[model samples]
Target: MEKKNALTAFAALSQPTRLDVFRLLVQVGEAGMSAGEIAAALDVRQNTLSANLSVLLHAGLVRNLREGRSIRYFADTEGLRGLLGYLLRDCCGGRPEICDPLIEDIACHARPTPLDKIGQYPTPEDHT
Candidate 1:
């Protein structure tokens, strides 16, 4: 992602409601949720949720799909990966030990699944 886009994403997540919504979506994963579902989950008003969702969509943090009368929103993993990669691209001047712990933390934060069950996440030993 471009530096400007990353800044926009960070700014969008800075708000309480938007941050909650984004985290909620991330937790929900690819199954996603409709506007109504998201509103009910967060106890946010439709109008307010719409505005926040719009900002997330613009920042490329969230994506929506039209499903009949409803729109299902998903966490834009690609965009998020790009943002994370940009931040960690040059970690501790290429020292894995300094960066491995941080990477582990990020992986944990990105998914709700157990590390053992989620084989996709790399263990510290994998990098060593």
Candidate 2:
């Protein structure tokens, strides 16, 4: 991502509601969720959620797909990865150990999984 794009993404994520929406979309994976479903899950009003979603969409953090009558919003993982990489690219300029643990953790969790595989999520049933 370009520096300007990273700045835009960071600015979009700076808002509380937008941050929650973005994180929720990330958790939802590539399948994503509809506007109504997201609003219900977050207990946010329709117009409010719509505005926040727009900002995130503009920031390139989320993408919307028209699925029949409903639009599904999914996280732009590539853009997010780029932003994270850009931020950490200059880390540990001299002392490699400064970021070794983080690199190890990322490597440990880097095993790829097919998007169709739905891991355990805290569904409504799980809440109770």
Winning model by TM-score: 1
Q: Please provide TM-scores, in order, for all candidate models, with all chains considered together.
A: 0.81, 0.77
Candidate 2: segments with Cα more than 4 A from true spot? 105-128
**Best of the candidates, lDDT:** 1
- Model 1 scores worst on lDDT over the 10 consecutive residues at 119-128
List, residue by residue over 2-120, the lDDT tens digit for candidate 2: 88889999999999988999989987785689888999999999999988988888787887876666677888877788889889987888687989888788653644775567754
- Per-residue error for 111 in candidate 1, Å, reads 10
Q: Where is model 2 poorest over a 10-residue stretch in terms of lDDT?
A: 119-128
Q: What is the overall TM-score of model 1 with all chains considered together? A: 0.81
